[model samples]
Each structure stands twice: as C-alpha cells, then as structure tokens.
Target: MDKEITIYDIAKGVGFSPTTVSRALNDHPAVNKKTKQRIYDIAAQMGYRSNLFASNLRRQHTNTIGVIVPILNSNFQSSVMAGMEKVANEAGYNLIISQSLGTMEKEIANAKTMYNSRVDGLLVSLSHDSESIEHFEPFFKKGIPVIFYDRVAEHKQSTSIVIDNVQAAYKATTHLIEQGCRNIVHITGNLKINVYTDRLKGFKYALVDNDLPYKKASVIATDLTEEAGIKAAEQILKMDPRPDGIFVANDFCAVNCMKALKQAGIAIPDDIAVVGFNNDPITRVVEPNLTTIDYPGYEMGEVAARNLTNYLDALSDVNITNTVTLRSDLIVRESSLKKKLKK
Candidate 1:
C-alpha cells in the first residue's frame, strides 16, 4: 500500500509550519496569496489531502450541501443537479447527493442521512409519495436552510423555486385545442404534489375556457414513468371514442406513450396529437418531434443554490417570500400540430 501524505509531510517538505500549511490549504483570507500558492504547490507535490471532516468540525461548517432527488438517471433531474454543482463548486461548497427512488420511505432515509452527516444546507425535490415533511424538522430547528425545487412542498417560510405548472399545462392544453383537439386526455403524475395538482387544474381550466366539458375520465393520473405511459396508451386505445389529443406531464413518458401508440397501429399527429413537458433531449430525438413545455431544470438549480448561499452568507433574505417562480415556454412541434395540408 502506498503511504498517505499529510499536512505534516507538506510542512516538512516546504519548511513551513503545519499551522500555516493548514490555514493556506483552507484558503484562509488572512493567508497572503503568495504564501497560499506556495503552500498549495508544496501540498500538491507531496500528494497531501486535507482532512475535510476534521477541518469542517474545527470551522463549525461542513461547506457541504445535501441534495435529494427522486432519481439520478433522469435527464431533467440530472440537469438540475449539474447546475447546482456548478454554482456550489464555484462557491467552494461540496454537494452530497442522494436519490429517493420516488418513495417516501427512501426520501425519509435520505433526509435522516443528510441530517446526520451535518450538511450545511439541503435542497430537495420531494418523492412521489412524500406526504409529510416531518423528516426535515431537524434542519429547520438547526436554522439550516432547506429549499425545494420542481416537485416542491408547501412550507410557511421555506423558499421554493419553480415555474407555474398550472399556466404551463394550460398553455399546452390550449395549444392542443387551437390545433383542433377537443376531446383531449391529460396524462400526469401523482397529484399529491403541487406540480401535478396545479397542472391538473390548468388542464381543467383550459377545457372550461373552450367550453369543453371537464370529465373525470379525461384526466389520467399516474406515476408519470415510462411504464405509466404505456399503461395510459393502453387505456386510451380502449376508450370508446379515442382521445383526439394527449397532454403528458413529462417528455420521457410522452415518448414512451408515442412508441406504445405506434405499436397499437395508431398514427401520431394524425390519430392523436400529443404534448409533453420538461422539453428533454428525447423530445427532439423522438420521431415527429414532440411539442413540450421548456422547464429550465439547470437554471432552477443554479438559482436555488445561489439563493441559499446568499442566505447562508447573510447577504440576502428569503423569509419575506415563500415562492420564486421561473419562466417556462411552450415549444410547438409536429407531434401536436394536427392540421393536415394537401400534399
């Protein structure tokens, strides 16, 4: 086994005190830039790594932020995390990320782990079944900021950054109607969270605006996964009068449904036009490019992390506001354009 290097080894090699090496490695502003550079160079030459836990304990700060998401493999969530890491890294903060697997049990366990790890702050997009947020009480008691993004929860004082899901869904539905789809089906996620519930409301409002009757059967609430998409497609196919249009909550799911519908011999844009959300890369890759709502996952993450950092540094306040809504755009494509022209 190779021998591990320490601050002592760097100090000995550079002829500087271990205290100076430690302070320099920590980027203490009091340490002159020249001294800090020399210490860093020596440390690199000696292959020395600072003991992060020991340093954090001494400084009374972990310099680490915890992030919990439903899944890490998701394109949307990954983009959000990428944005968060970029901002947090630039601010000299480390990110400790975990997945909830879309379950409340896993989310609770992750919250506990983050709490026990002594994370300086937390950012969470709640799980599909996360009804109660009691697990986050410890962070609140400790004055550690907890911000929610995307799949958010309603807290009296905590900050949440998200786009207006209701309006986005309304736009998607209204677009379908404009393209000549009256009997539209709305496929969405579990309505326990605000994102899905608000979108459902928007879908209803769009129908009501055009004087189309809002029927309970028109709304198909599910987990919004690929499997759920297949199931929705199956259900739509079996309907007495098949839906003229479909508005899905996620692009991935929408793409999956498109595949399933095609397998069932249903022609997309001709038989049933579709619109999806999140504007994921798959939307463009799918045949007959999908119309979607551009949910700025990366931007949301950057803004959330920056705001939390500002609050932690006492440079900004979040208590005065409860929610910060970002802008979302509707991107039209062949998938939702139902008008047929003479060829």
Candidate 2:
C-alpha cells in the first residue's frame, strides 16, 4: 500500500518548516501569501490529504455533524438530507449520516457510534417504536447539541423542526368533508409518533366540527408502507358501508392505496375521494393526481440545520427546543375535486 503524504513531506520539498506548512494549510494569516501558495502547491503535488481527526483534536471541534434517520430511501428524508448537506457544506462542516432502519437497537448503536466519533452536534429523526430517547443521553451529558426534525422525541436540550401535523391533517379531512365525504377513513402509521398521533387528533377534531361520528375503526393505524396501503384497502372494503373518502398520512401509501382501490373497480373522486400528505413527486405522476398537503420538508431541514449552525457560530442564542412549526397547505387536485365541472 502506498504511504499517505504528510505536511512534513511537503515542508521538506518546499524548503519550509513543518510549522509553516501546517499554518499555511490552515490558511493562517501569519504566513506570507506567496509562501502559503508555495506550500499549498507543493502539498497538492505530494498528494497531501488533511487529517480531519487531528484537526478536530487541535480545535476541540469536530467540524462534523451526525445525522440519524429511520431510512435513507424515502423521498422526504432524502430531501431533508440534501438540504442539510448544502447548509453544512457551505459552513465548512461535514455530515456523517446513518440509518436506524426503524429499529431502536440500530438507532442506539448509531447514536453510540456518533458519540464515539466525536461529532460536534447531532440531528436525529427517531425510529418507529422508539419509546424513549435514552440513547441520546450521552450527547446531552457531553453538552453536544442535538436537533430533531420530522420524527422527533421529547427532550429538553434538543430542538425540533416540524409542521403542525394536526392542523394539516385537519385541513385535509375538513376538505374531504366539504366535498361531501362523511364516512372518512384515516390511514396512517403507528400512533406512538407525535406526527401520526397529532394527525389522528386532527382527523377526529375535523369530524367533530362537522357533526360527523368519530369511530375507532375509522382510523386505521399501520406502518404506512406500500403493503400497508393494500391492507388498508382490504380493511376499508370490508366495512358494511365503505368509506367515501380516505386521508392517508403519506403520499407513497396514498398512491398505492389508490392503485389497490382502482384494481377493485372503484372510481376515484366520483365514488371516493382521497387526500395524501407530503406532496411527494409520485403524487403528481400517478393517475388522477393525488390531492395532498405541500409539506416543506427541505425547508424544514434548512431551518433546523441553519439554527444549529447559528448557535454553533455564536451568531445567536435563540431557543430551538420549542416547537418550530413551518407552513403547510392543502393542495387540491383531481383526486379530491368533487365540485361539478362547468363545460
């Protein structure tokens, strides 16, 4: 294996001391501009790579942020990560991302890895069935800043950036009710998550406001996966009087459910209307384009990352732990358009 080149190698070749080479590499103003350029040119010629670990040890700041998410394939989470990466990169910081695969054990392990890696901060979206956030206690104890986005947990020191799921869900359900859908069914993920639980509350509240009966069977809680959509369809189809409308927690599940319903010879909008959340790209691509909520996921990520960066840069001391609710809106489409079309 080829040996890694160091500053000393560059220093020897450039006729400068290691200290001068090191300072030049770090862009210290003490080194003359021409001398610094000479050292940099020689370092590049010698294939020198900066050691972030040693640099972090010297500055007591890792220049690395750790991010833990349930899964990496989801469109929403990927957009969030993209936004985070853009902000972190602009700030001269690196991001170390890991997936929990929606398992608490994996999440715990990831947390420990981040801590051991000496990350300056952490950003987490908790896993399903993660009852407690005990894994993050080490970060809290070590004075590391932890920020939560999307799937957040209740923690005093950490901050959360999310939309008002209750309000968004309420708007979606109410829109369906306005379109004359009384027997509305809500398909969602585990109610253990604040997002799902809040959406459930919103669904009920919308029903109550419209004088519609709120039935436990009306709210079907699942993992909100593609298979879960088919299962939800089966459950709804089994009901004596099938639901006239459905409000799904996410666009992917909603689109899949629509496919299942279509396969069952159900006419969308004419027979049953549907509304989905997140406004994912697939929503628009699918036939009878899904009506959804325009969730600002990337914006949420940018705001969360920027908030932490500001705090780290000594630019601000604003409290971020308090709920930071971003704007979300109902996007009406063919799936939920029930009004008579004027020809």
Best by TM-score: 2
Stretches of candidate 2 above 4 Å error? 1-59, 341-343
Listed in order, each prediction's TM-score against the native is: 0.81, 0.82
Across residues 76-155, which tens digit of lDDT does each residue of candidate 2 receive?
Answer: 99999999988988987899999999999888878876776678888899999799999899788867889998988878
lDDT of each: 0.87, 0.87
In angstroms, give how far residue 33 of model 1 lies from its true place. 51
Per-residue accuracy of model 1 over 176-293 as CA lDDT, tens digit each: 9998897999998888888989999999999999999999998888888889999999999998788999999989899999999999999889889999999999999998899999
Clashes of each: 0, 0
Residue 284 in candidate 2, Cα distance off native in Å: 0.5
Task: Quote the lDDT for 319 in model 1.
Answer: 69
- lDDT, candidate 1, residue 118? 73
Positional deviation of residue 17's Cα in model 2 after best superposition, in angstroms: 37
Question: Candidate 2 at 187: error in angstroms?
Answer: 0.5
Least accurate 10 contiguous residues by lDDT in model 2: 50-59
